[model samples]
Target: MTFSIKDDSPLVSVITPSYNCSAYIKETIDTVLDQSYPNWEMIIVDDHSQDDSVQVIQSYEAMDSRIRLIPLANNVGAARARNIAIKEARGDYIAFLDSDDLWLPTKLDEQVEFMKSGNLAFSFTSYSLIDEQGHSLAIEVKAPQTVDYKHLIGNTTIGCLTVMLDRKQIKHIEMPDIQPEDTALWLSLLRNGYQAHGLPKILSKYRIVSNSTSRNKWKAAYRYWKLLRVQEKLNIVEANFYFTKYAYNAYNKSRGLQPVSIQNGGK
Candidate 1:
């Protein structure tokens, strides 16, 4: 499926699945409000957060009509929260950003332009890694020149914060109930022969908190292994090979080797 951009294109829906993310919720909302592109709505789904996340989102919604807050009655996981947000989304395009991440002002503008120009169904941009304090960690990522089912297995090179998709094509596809929902969605798209394009510019900030899930090496490894099994069902050997690399990198990183830069390394 292909789409051409019109001057009166429908607004893009940016879905943010929030849990107990009080620490970074304010900054996340601010970043979305600061987007250079004006034709977008921010749908923030609070997954029954125990923290002040709901209040924060409510305040934002009170200030901007475009920012809508939906409070889930139950504490469902991120996958379910995102699925709910997508179901409620009313836009021609869909974009995702985690509550702990921040987007550069031009993020939506750049990505929307790329998608329209390339006639792409989905696309993602590069991003920089920041510490919990929002300090640059001197880590930046450039996505592969091209992405395929095999290349995505071991490493989730595309940050979830950077992804944008055409709602017309992806609205019917749902995020799987998997450990890593982002990777699962990407795999589904790849399996269905939907190509993903990357704009090699750092358009967002990915926060790495001390107690974040990425820090839990053991759980991460287990999840990677499970994702590998799913990829195996699709007969993707490259996914399995990359999963091994991912596991090794996670282990090495936990031991203090820089996971992003160690050559020929997998966590």
Candidate 2:
């Protein structure tokens, strides 16, 4: 399962939407800078952060040419901020990394190799959960080998930070201005005949803060339902069916029942 990435590897545009994540933005930036894959640019879109997040990002950008900062005058939202970055991205591949999230060094290397080897247009990797203080909770969400629109409807395990899309193959893929916008984008691509292959490696770290949307299960469910019924416009029965499966998966992942090794071929 070893792969090699050359110096002239395909350029990866890493997009990050920042919103008052000063506490953890530095480490996040550091993680990206330390990636084993060198041919990449990180666009950290700041959504009018009220803290020192921008300062931290700027400090890093000052040192590294690969790191760029897009500061918004007014606070829009995560989806909109990401869209702005997407519009300006100049790379063969599009990748997402949130401000508070962390990526392991080999993330880009492994994922890019996986996609290139399999001729995959879209792909994601498994990620572990971290607490607000950056302590591992020993919980990892597993990703399936391959998922289409239908499979995604029943199992929404694709993490935004773990996802990498081949823009050369799939074009005009933007995050919708809605709750769970990332998921919406994934579904839209899959619906349009793009299958996302999962690498199943723990290559990213998702930080769970108290105010995180994932913490509010009921609210998250409601927003997901809205995404299905309103944004994507699935029929009531289809929406309910997908929503039910989503709820079950969410419950299981919350309980740490679906560990990374178990889902990723017991690796």
Which candidate gets the maximum TM-score versus the true structure?
A: 2
lDDT of 2 by residue, 191-228 (tens): 77888898988999999989888688888988899988
Highest lDDT scorer: 2
TM-score of each: 0.88, 0.92
- RMSD of every candidate to native, in Å, equals 5.2, 5.1
Q: Ten residues in a row with the worst lDDT in model 1?
A: 258-267
- For model 2, the stretches where C-alpha displacement exceeds 4 angstroms are 1-7, 259-267
Flag regions of model 1 displaced more than 4 Å.
1-7, 231-240, 248-267
Task: Evaluate model 1: give its TM-score.
Answer: 0.88
Per-model tally of clashing residue pairs: 9, 0
Clash list (residue pairs), candidate 1: 154-242, 154-243, 246-267, 247-267, 248-266, 248-267, 249-266, 249-267, 250-267
